[model samples]
Target chain A: MTIRDEHLRQALQHAPDRLSAPHENTSRAVLSYARQTLEKEQRVWWQSCMMWLKKPLVSNWQRAGVGGLATALVVMLIFWQMAPEKATWPDAFPEHAFNTDKNNAVALMKDKNAAELNAPLMRRKARATGAPAQEQTMATQPGHVIGQGEHQSIALDHSSPATNEIASAPISAPAVVAGANDSSGAMSSANQARGSGSQKTEAASAELSEAKPVKKDAVLDIMQLLDSIKNEGGQTVAARDISLSKLRMLKLDMSTTKQENSAPCLQMATVDASPDMETGYPVLMVSICDSSMQLINGVAEYNQQMQDYWYRQLQKKNNER
Target chain B: MGESITTDEDLMRKFCAGDMRAFELLYQRHERPIYRYIRRLMGGAFNAQADDVFQDVWIRLIDARLQWQPRENASFKTWLYTLAHHRTIDILRKSGREVSVDEGWLDDEPGSPWQSWPAAHALEPEQQVFWRKAGQRLLHCLDGLPAMQRAAFLLHHEDGLSVDEMRLVLNAEFEAIKSRLRYALFKLRACMGAYLPPMVD
Candidate 1:
């Protein structure tokens, strides 16, 4: 019969039974802990509510709704806190140490040398234990890992030794900040000097030494500035108008290399980068120009032939339209 | 008993009214059953994680006591066991480790624990050792049961809930409920017959 059968029920009634008497101390201990926790939370909520009453952002009607939302977000954040960290890089990348076992063919030619290399094979047999593989790789390679061609058109304005060159980049026009409250060549004095018809460029690198809001629209603004400078600085037309494609292809070392002052932030002087057209290795050019097309510093390399070609093409399209 | 201690609800009301002694009495009545229930339902599968589940179950009870009128129809013990059951089932489901619930596995079977009586007297001592043994034996028998059958049996037998009550708990049909209980009892008797051999009180 099954344990639920009447015979099994009768058998079980007399079956050896173990009963646990609760420990008075532990019971008291648990009760006190629960009470204290609730009391503490109640006190904290009251204090925060009092603070809110003094200067409230929420309306009386919206108070409960806001509190509920905040509570939900807090609970979500707590759950998220318990979640395992997701791997930052895609998983397909070769195992970080997979390349280390290279063919040192010549070095290991000798039979004795081969034996020595294999000596520690047993001792070094350490499996990746508790920590994850991602952690292992991160623990090894500690800095910015930019793949070749991944961001050729991007500027990593980092302060490593290479960025000192960026501070003195060849300027071909007055640097115009399109969104700058005043693009009246204030941030451009450095640009006019670079475009002074001098093939022999001077090394005048200035690094803005201050924390500035890194703008996502900074590249677009820079492109607009190139256009404005080309039109306004008419006579001082130097090389070519910076196109969006060209800007995308070019990477500025906007990474803070040196600090000149707080307000004068994020300024990196180009070291000695030849104009991309000249070197064929993509170059980032910074220029400063006035509304009247005056070159304060930097180069105004606006290619007249290209600009005219684009202008005529546009005119043709407009006529068709 | 004079000052209103008819049920767990009464004791809880007294406890909430600052009667520390009443709270002690209630814990004495429940601590083992809840712990043993948890041990049986999720022993070694979540053995290390059992302490955490135990603490969480009690914390939930503490919260329930602070707010609700305790219970009237479903005893506090049954309610607590139900919470433990639901929480555990949810945990297993979330981990994607549990199998699909098939009522066929629980369809009418015989020679199970709930079908007979001798099995109920399994735990004989609690002073020092058998209490611990009972917990282990309970977990072993439960692990041997099909998940649905196991859940049903616990709801009906250990939890002392009626078939209708179990229908609500398992969300199963009335006929399906009977089958699960039968199947669970059959499996328990087979698994624990040696551990719960006939004995006299």
Candidate 2:
């Protein structure tokens, strides 16, 4: 601010001005270096990308958002791959070949007999077992005289003429009948029934022959009743969908039907028939009037023994007379 | 109409975009001031390294063109001087010269080499001679001052920087710049006063 300070400032300014300028060569060299560097420094595409990545392109919030979105996408993809596929109706119900429309199903059940409705299924099963489809249908028909053991004969009153002839023929030797009741007692009953002719066994056989027609009629009535109930219930009886309550109700109905008949003993057993076309579930068939057979949970060995004893007694009386 | 004068920042931007003429203009504009800043800061003993340091400063400015941003309230000249100041300091330090800018050197009593010189008579010729001698002595006095104080003095007086610009160039606090300038002016005055005759009131 003072004269002395102002003078010193001026002196200092004038003293150092233009005192130590760089030589022309140094300036030329620096410019030449700049030119060389600018011309030659051509970065490749990947190098440019790397440079961009190395720089802070986004803020902390943007980075977090991007990371979270990527993580969520990955998790969703993993879950989508790991999830189980759902079973469609066709996969669950292989018998989709049968009518699915409620009205059509009821009409079909009403118009067709059990044999006619089960014909397709029976054909499939016959193919699987390597048996003729006609033979299988005839074997399941009423009054077919399906014998269980070598000496045992079952006679129904509605018997076909050929089956009636076979039932009435005298047993000279053990006969190996081809039927659905292929039980283990088949061969053993021939020897067991040789010398056991009791009066009770003969009387029971006569009673069975007399009541055969009633039993046949009762079985047909029960089948028609069950078909009507199934149609009214608006549900097809699939093998898997048949609950225990429905089976119990069927057993109660059969017991009522038996009470109405003159047959002293009525037995039933649930046996697996052919597998369904699509679902592969075993079709359930209820065998009635076979004392040698037992319910699903009953002791088959005891029932078979009892039936074999009765059969042997009947065969012995036939031999004696 | 007057032609628009292009600012240093504009020239630097044009240089960054590959205009060699802009760079040449920039280099020409700053060459003397920057070179003298290095030379003065390095002092007479390290004068040989000044050219190298000066070239390094310009080369650094050239290399850093891409990274340069026009700072708020600071010019390209301040930035250039800053680079020169730092490079000169680095060279001095690497050469093992005493580059300390601490205030410890301020307390050292002024030498009496100017005491034996005869007084100038009150004539224009003698006055001119006296002032010329004083100018040469001022450069010598600048060499004796501490690096930071000398920088403060030369930056303000020679390069015509304001106090704030000196703060940016020196990378020091405002008050620190003020104190360094004050000390620089005081020391230069004391040194030059030894050559002045007794005041005639």
Candidate 3:
């Protein structure tokens, strides 16, 4: 290096030696400032968490829990509202429902002995005529018992005068003697004569004998049940679960049973149809009654067109017979 | 109190890893030279701006410890001076002052080299007073040089940076850094010789 360059470098290098250093206070302050800044950065995580928790109303987690609970409650309420109502006693055993006897009658005729078949018809006819007839008390019998004193005859004293008049009607020997093969024909003839008002009482007894058995037997069985309870000093029957199958069996038993003529009870009338033997046209027999199981009404006349149709069918059936 | 035998880059790495003691060692090693560089670059710590710029450079160094690594071509000292140089220029510009080194300003009053040469002698009180006066005059002349020249001169002469290192710190081409240093030396020699001439050999 040149003398001038060497001297200039030496002078500039030595010049800084005379200048002042930074104050101790400023060095400490800058270091302290940096530490504070870094310390703040370090705490950012937990500080942010605390900030989130300080939010109004509730935290996000609690809102999720409450939302879940609300959704569950809504689902439960929807299912509850949509669920079916339990069947009430009256609905379970309605006062008037389609009697299933029509469906079972064919089975009964095919299954039972001729004696078993004739017994129910004879008892039903006897009760319908209101003669001094015996009622079968055995529960196995598909017929209702009429209790009167120590004997099993129904007492006619509690009945209205009209009922007493019915009870006092004479039983025709021809009706009592008709074979099961001729019963339906005899019943039809008696019904036709009654339509003319000449044989009303006699014909009504025959037709009603068929009508009252199903519903009246059920009512009488319930009455017989209540009577047994009364005989045991009227203790309340304990509640029990009646299964649907057992209920259906009770319904079948009630429907197949014959009803004796006695006190008033709930009644259900059924229609039976058969093809005329010769004409092969449908013949419909409809039994009519009031709610009291009393034969106060009758299906005397159909449409005039139907009467001619039915008369042709009946005459053809009689000729075939 | 013991000067750390570790290199500046190693100290910086240690500081980045949270060894504050290594940072303090690095600070103590470079603080005086950096403070002087900024002090002379802004005329002195007499101006509050010079102090502000001085502290800013050190704080930047501390703050940048985590990001600092010694590259193949650049030393920690180059990086340190680069930070100080940039901060000085920023303060100077923000204060609305231009940094101009008038190389011709010395030519206007050129005295022959021997006219102000002090006699060669063993170190004496009279020679010390003359050198002290000469040193004060050189510092005053440094203040008048252009900002880039003063920075180049200080990085070269005071911080002992090579021309290539100055290029890195000053962010100028190597030749530009050389020219700035050459011009700075020329002016300081002229200015100081006019005030107190060295004895001619």
Candidate 4:
């Protein structure tokens, strides 16, 4: 074994070293064969991906077009959800939305007196024709049990309809239209105040009781995100963090720069400097003039310096005279 | 080398976008490593069956269009070895079912038994024949290793997959891959009596 090992080492070194690595013809042939097979089979494999076209969740048509449509739909839906609500200035404000409602809501905010709180919840009581007025009035106010009974009755009667259920369960809470003095009346009144412009609004109203003001941290987070976006995306500085007051106070005589229907939009030709001068900050919409930006304070100081230079030159001439 | 489909991933990317010639380009590029890997894998096992399997491994790769998503975890090399390992296991697991645990050569410098042998410059042709015979014996010793270990050691030595890739190929744990490699080297050293003498002088 020792001699054999020694010889093995010698053979490796002595074998003329083959001048180069193997020609690798077989390797090439096998790989080429594989390539051909792959090319041939790729068609079938790609077909499997599309074979089940009927599944709505996984359709090539859906992937090619429906995915886009679904994405667009989701985006539009999010936009619709995020869109600033168009307030329908009601032709006439509903009677329920009178100042009385606001006052009542604020007053009953902490009031636990059921009777006093329920005062706003008066509803037209069902009565037989020609019933005595006194009886009808008494019937409307059944002290406590009748009110509880009415709640139970409403809950039983108006609960959501159970359809196609194994058991026709009268289980869920009914859509009970509360009477005038009900707490829910105030809630529904609140919902009405914030008009359900769309289903999202209605859903939002349902969640109104649980809603809280936007968190300061969340606002800070959003602002930070926007700042990073600006930094990374090279957005115009004028778009964010520019205190509008600083620019509006420029005291720029409109005639100095005014040419066309140019306003304060951030375009160049729109807010260009005249042959003499134009005093405007870097309105992005405005043309880039020497660094293309200025603050009102900076501009004012620049103007003062220019005036001083002229005045000094005039003073020197007078002294020479 | 015949109409090959040799595209490196970088090349495949160009080809994926309706480049017919891209496929052939990639085949030509990867032809050697892939061929050697298969050739070495099914050494004597190379019959009609192995020919089909070897060809299929390439076909499998091509069909995978795996070049599309060259993932971080499933690397191109790992994926290729993964296919190769599975096929080797399928071929060999039929009889000598014991899993061999290769103990050395996992992650270190190359130290084959041939390293310790006398330099060929000193040897004549007759001595060269003895060295050749010894090399053949080393292969026999390699054959004693577990099917996957032999395959892993050979693949790593020849094909140059990373240790992590070996883990993927073997579907074994990282420590296990390391030890398997260590064991293979230690055994090879023992088998090569010249390198690892039984009674040191």
Candidate 5:
């Protein structure tokens, strides 16, 4: 629009345009250097570690080792589980030597595991007192027998014809006779034989010669035992005799008598030969019988309170004398 | 590789994408202008120093290939000139040379461009002599101008850069570049007005 603007534009338009060209060598040298650098990076050895990480599948060695370990572990566990355990006795005591009934009797001489032999006793107690087997084990507190005693027997008076016939026949003790009442009465028969026969004979000889130590003057805790029986809901039987030294066998009548009848059945003598808990004492011999004193096959509920009461009375009488 | 029709920016992108052929085309197209820029910025000395700066500008372009992004308004020519301008200034500064922005020192000088003129006519002999004198006087005036003003003038006239694009190339404020170009034109007009061909009326 003005004079200066027109002239200035014309001057800028005619400005010198001289510029020299770049030499040829410089371009070729720089391009080659860059390509070499890229190629060198591609050829490096450490890139293999990255390639290994990028691999998708597991290697064959890993699969074989892991699967083999798993299979061996499973097989070992199955074989270990399938192996059966053998029952072991102490090395000093041979297993076969104690397998006979005689050694079984000796093993039970302490009577600690008399309850293991309690299946027949359980059945007889169930029959006599109408109590459950578990309750019978809780109710009965067994006492030991004094050495060389004249055995007194108790019988349940059953009016059944078969039991009446068994009641009519009586067997002398120190003899092995089959019981007439039931197969479960076989233990009572064996108890009768053992109490009166060879075992008692050997025990009396051992006591007379002082070859065996006799445990005497032990505390008789009949009250706790009677309470356990009374808690079991049974009739309190009375014991007429209290001479524990003269007492030996108890006879239970396992006659097929229904327990609903409330009769004075257990005619046991009250004898206190109770001992310390750790003392291995035998269960007093019990003979199952009917009214005629026939050795009947049975188990009887022993009324411990009546026996303790009578035993205490006898002790009082002996002290007075 | 035919560079006549291809845009500078497209060739820059192709070169950035690792096409060496595109880089060669781009270098050929830009090398002369960038070299002249450096030479003028170096006070018109076409020496080893100027050649080193010239090579450095292209080398910088090659190194920046991975980082180049196509942008709006800033063309490849502007970017190339900017690299040449900065490298030249840096070399000048490192060598402790001051760019003469002082137009006062240029006063009382007679050999300035446009001292005499011959109108465009059928008089061929006088026009050729006038043209040579005009070119020489222009070179002399440019040499006398300040480094930054000369850069602004050259980037504007030689590279055809607008004020904003020259802002990017000069790495300068818009008004600073605008003023520098204005001052540069004023000095050139005051110096070269006499020798320019007369306007055809």
Candidate 6:
């Protein structure tokens, strides 16, 4: 270093000596203040925490690790809340009941038989009440039939052998029947008769069970009918025709004759009618039958009339009633 | 007989442990340079006299004693100056006298006062008086320097801090500290040249 540089350093180092030093009293004051400060200082827990957080000694990576752990804990808590529960099915059914294919099929068969046994009672109850009963019955049964009228609907009860027999019969066989609108007393009496009829059905079912192959064929027939009807847009013959024993006999013959046929066995024609408007003629009389059926007596009466004439006749007939 | 020298870090650690003697020793060790640093750096700013800033630095150091740690290659002295440097710079900034270290004050015209003074050789008979006046003029020159440049100069020359230690004390980069020291020296020399003779090879 140059002499000038050395002199400059020496000059600067000695320069402060020319200036007045802090008084000795200042030192005493500072130390006494420090003693008092140290004695009086009291840090709370939060203050200590804040000091730690603000501490420069804590590295950036450590702070980052703490933040990341907190974020992960929050995310884990959210997922724990949103997670789906285990064991959603009812406890009455064992988890293993449907574990195997064979067990699954057996369970399903028992359910089907139980549903069939319950269907007739439900239908009887529905007919005894009215629209509300029909809706309740329909909720329990999968099969639905929309009638010709916009508001008329029927829930097919599989427990009735005649209805099942008609479902299994050839499409061209059963003739549509026109029945009088029965009063509540008539329906209650009919339900009583059906209750007695169910006893006979149970005996027939017992006999069919003795012939296992025949019972299996019957079940197959029912399943096939349901599948075909479902595939063919779920329409059925009117409820009035379904209750007729004459059509039941005709369907029994048709089912026996066409037992081997795999084609759709049931044909349906939906007739649209307004439930509020009373028809002068029976609802079945106004319905159009398929070409395969001979409407022998009603055709002559309806052939020469316009729709307005029938409507006028219906109004007059309703007035007389 | 060998006397064990207690390092500044050791003194600070003892002070943190409530040793008043250690604090007194530490305070006395740094008292003069620190007070001069504040006084000279603040340089006639109103209400920022050296004693006030000096007491503030010591009080801050005492209050934050528990937070002090002996970093590798850094002493308690550097930390103490760091506090003083920051506090003085804050005062300088608030008083609006904070000059940029990079300001071009070296381009003063030939008619400047320092240029008109008699050369150092002409006053060889009164060397003692001339040196005293030169030292006083050097202090004046220091006050005229930018706050950071003055701090850099004082930290280096007055406190014997190396460029690296000055970097820690001033919170500046190595190159920045180096440049500040260079500017400080150049300006001081230009101001001090009026008192010294041109060297003969």
Best by TM-score: 3
Of candidate 1 chain A, the 10-residue stretch with the lowest lDDT total is A101-110
Please provide, for model 2 over B5-103, each residue's C-alpha lDDT reduced to its tens digit, 9 standing for 90 to 100.
Answer: 888899898888887778878887888878888888888788888888888998898888898899887889988988998998888779887765654
lDDT of 4 by residue, A277-308 (tens): 22122111111111212332343343333333
TM-score per model over all chains = 0.36, 0.43, 0.46, 0.35, 0.42, 0.42
Q: Model 1 captures what fraction of native contacts?
A: 0.08
- The global C-alpha lDDT for each of the candidates, from Candidate 1 onward, is 0.43, 0.52, 0.48, 0.40, 0.46, 0.50
Worst 10 residues of 3 chain A by lDDT: A244-253
Give the per-residue lDDT digits (tens) of candidate 1, residues B141-161: 566666677777655555466
TM-score of chain A of 3: 0.16
Off-target runs (Cα >4 Å) in candidate 4 are: A1-321, B1-7, B18-20, B43-49, B66-68, B95-117, B120-134, B195-201
lDDT of 4: 0.40
Which number leads on lDDT?
2
* Model 2 misplacement above 4 A: A1-4, A41-321, B1-4, B103-128, B194-201
- Computed on C-alpha atoms, the DockQ of candidate 5 is 0.12
Candidate 3 — which residues are off by over 4 angstroms? A1-4, A13-19, A37-321, B1-3, B44-46, B100-108, B194-201
Separate DockQ for every predicted complex: 0.06, 0.25, 0.19, 0.07, 0.12, 0.23
Pick by DockQ: 1 or 4, better one: 4
**What TM value does model 5 have?**
0.42
| A1-321 per-residue lDDT for model 1 (tens digits) | 123444333332322332432345545567786667555555667687766755666665456445544654564356335533232211212123112112210000112333233333212211212324442332233221222111111222322223222222332211111112112243354344223412111111110111122232332344444545545552233223232222211322222222122212222212112333322222343322232223222222233323334344445665686
True-structure lDDT of candidate 2 = 0.52
Residue A103 in model 6: shift from native, Å?
73
Weakest ten-residue segment in model 4 chain A by summed lDDT: A265-274
